[model samples]
Target: MRAAVLTGFGAPLSVRSVPEPRADGGEVVVEVLATCVLPYTGEVFGGRRDYPLEPPVVPGPGGVGRVVRVGPDATRLRVGDLVWCDPTVRSRDDALTPDIMLQGLSSRGEGGARLARHLPDGAFAEFMRVPTENVHPLPPEALDDPARWSCLVVYAIPYGGLLAAGLEAGETVLVSGSTGNLGSAAVAMALAMGAGRVIAPGRDRAALDLLADRFGRRVRPVELTGDEETDRDAMSAAARGPIDVVIDLLPPAAPSSVTRTAAMTVREFGRVVLMGGVGMLGGADLALPYPWLMRNSVTVRGRWSCPRTANVGLIRLIASGTLDLSPDRIRTFPLDAVNDAIAYAAAHGGPFDRTVLTPRAG
Candidate 1:
């Protein structure tokens, strides 16, 4: 087997041949078909807080793949099945409850039984052995180009957040960072879930135009100028109508002005869902309107990962073709270029697109 192995913090991943894995009892070996290029891969490279990570490991949250080998004890899935192989799973036990077992991110777990991120080896390889229960069969439409559909999980990030915030049909939504991978996913799901209109704000104008072109008029674009008042006014005008929900997908380190702009765009008593990694924000304080929130009864919430129920519901919606997510752009890479793929995702700023690595030998 070949994988992109990270040797240490801030080191580039090296492509090297390693031992191919066999499906142990209760596990299944997937011939990697496609995996999303997550920006968080860079965080793993730099060693995020309390992660206790080291080199010589494969890092991936998992993606769509076909079952190549099934362990003797595995019952639900069979070889040749196309499935979503995100290693993370929700756990009720206290030991793993903080975040659904931190699945697909943690590097330690005993193969098929307990939830763990695949240590020493990850989905950025030709083959990966995953827990049988973690695999969910996907529809044939998704399988035709698994890389594109593999992004269904990203959209689920916003879907779950919206529903949890008590989203109502025909409500309007304002999504910050609307041109990034997660932001773009949020826009798609907001419309599919029945948001009457969506306002997408970002720094790039071309990307905004592109999204507006794909999603049609229902999606309005907001270009943020560095000038605070200018950006705020633009956002407010785009969202002239009351915004039912505000989805904050900005990087944790983003300027407080971004949140303030988003806050100003929301309608009174509207909800705000702040989500995603802390990398971009980095402890920045939000310039929230305390008086407004108190007077209008606004509720603010934070979320980590998509809960199991939300993940299941979104998958059903996509499988039923109710979500119509085929407009997403997917960039392809070979197994040998996993590092480049991750870097590309980390550097991309123009438009939202999914970077996918294909490990199958052609």
Candidate 2:
């Protein structure tokens, strides 16, 4: 099997032959069809992000593939089944608070790192070994173009945050940092889930215009001025109706003030779900006014990733034609060009532009 191996941080990923993964207990081996090359993949690979990824690992988060083998515990899954490989691998021992690890990417902590040791490789190769529960069967139609379906990995994150925020149909929702990849996906997912109006706020004016053009009147794009108070007012005014829910998907480079600005726009008793990288790299902690929360009865929650079942719901949306994955939105690279794929993804990480690696040859 051919794979791109990360021998060390700051070192180039070497494309070479490696042993194909075998199905172990409670695991499934899938032939990699299409896997995403995230914008920050270069950062993690170059030691800039300092993610807890051990050396000599195949690094891809999640992807769309076909099952080739399954463990004895699997009853429903079978060979040749098209499936979405979920990267969120949780420790099965603890149901209440499972230690999480993004298989083939990074671990949460020591506990997650331990879990990664068991399944260290990701979907960057011809075949990947995934936990049985992490594999979700897709509709037969997905076979037409697996590369487009790979966007599911991006949409799943925002879908999870929206679910955490308790988003309801026909309610107004605001997606902060909506010009970026995941944030833009949140805007699309919100509309698909029946949000009456989506307020998209971002610093990129051209990107904001693109969102408005793509979604029409249902989407309101506001160019953020970097002024917290002003941005907050802009979002509130764009909503037309009271903002019922606010989902913050700002990246690490964004200031805490930006998240606070969008969150404060939600109406009283509204919910806010935080699923961004804002304080992860190191900066001032996000501070929401205590008085405002107490008086307004606001509900705020932090979400790491979507629930395990999010993939099922997301696939339903795709199957139902609510969420469209137009092929024009993605750029596909062959498995041998994994390094080139990483570069392309980083350069084109804007909203609606996706870069994916097709591991299997045509």
Candidate 3:
């Protein structure tokens, strides 16, 4: 099989022929149809702390493909079924264990490594393998519109964050980095989940306009002009009386102003869910003022959407059409063009709503 092989950190992935993966016991081999590129992939390949996996490793978090073969004990899925595999792979024991997930973090079980080896050799490859548990049946409609399911890969994080924050219908929520992929998803999901209003703050007016067109009056746009007083006034106006929750999806190295704006905008006693920046690529240096958090009685939370349980709900939401994701948000490339795709995403200032790699030409 031809795959995008990462030879080293900070190096371009090359198209190379690799052995076709077989369905091992308790696993299934998937004929790769589509896999999405994550913004974090570059940071991971660049040897960032958020991605601990050594390079020469395949990069991907979510994909949808057809099952060609299945291992014994993999009863939930069968050959010829189309499914979306959960990006996070974990063992039964680890799932039961306190806090370990597959691929992105260290774990005691072989499941993570094995599943990592299974996924399309690289997310940019022709075929892949995964544990049966990793596969979720995709609606035929979703297969016709791959972008809908592909964006699910990126949206899952915000979904989990909103759920964890215990968001309720009719409550107002503020999202930082509203133009990025996760930020856009947060805005969409908050509206779909019935928030009274979704305030999205960002520096990119074009992206904000796109979101506003999709969401209409439900989406409020804020532009950060790099002026402290302006940002504070914007936050004050956006927050008004109070916000029920604040979803911070800023990059790891997001400008300090953004973090300060987020800290200032959230309502007192409201939850601030940090899902995007703390661990991964760029937003690591962002700091929160401890005194402000204490004074406001704000609850700070961190989330990484790697649990199977989380994926299950996300799949159901897609099936139900509540997600309302579209393919126009995605830009597709062949496995051989992985490097080009990564460079494009970086240059575009992405957290793309969806970017996919296909093993074969459509």
Best by TM-score: 2
TM-score ranking of the models: 2, 3, 1
Q: What TM-score should be assigned to candidate 3?
A: 0.86
Query: For candidate 3, which ten residues in a row score worst on lDDT?
Result: 99-108
Residue-level lDDT of model 1, residues 108-216, one tens digit each, is 2343224343333568888887767777888777767778776765776788788877878889899887887788878888888888889998887787988899889
- Worst lDDT 10-window in candidate 2: 321-330
lDDT against the true structure, each candidate: 0.74, 0.91, 0.71
Model 3 C-alpha lDDT per residue in residues 176-246, reported as the tens digit of each score: 88888678878888887778898888888889888788888877888888887788688668656577788
lDDT of 3 at 116: 47
Ranking by lDDT: 2, 1, 3
lDDT per residue for candidate 2 within 70-113, as digits (tens), equals: 99999999999999999999999999989999998889988999
Off by over 4 Å in 2: none
- Candidate 2, clashing residue pairs? none
Question: What TM-score would candidate 2 get against the native?
Answer: 0.98
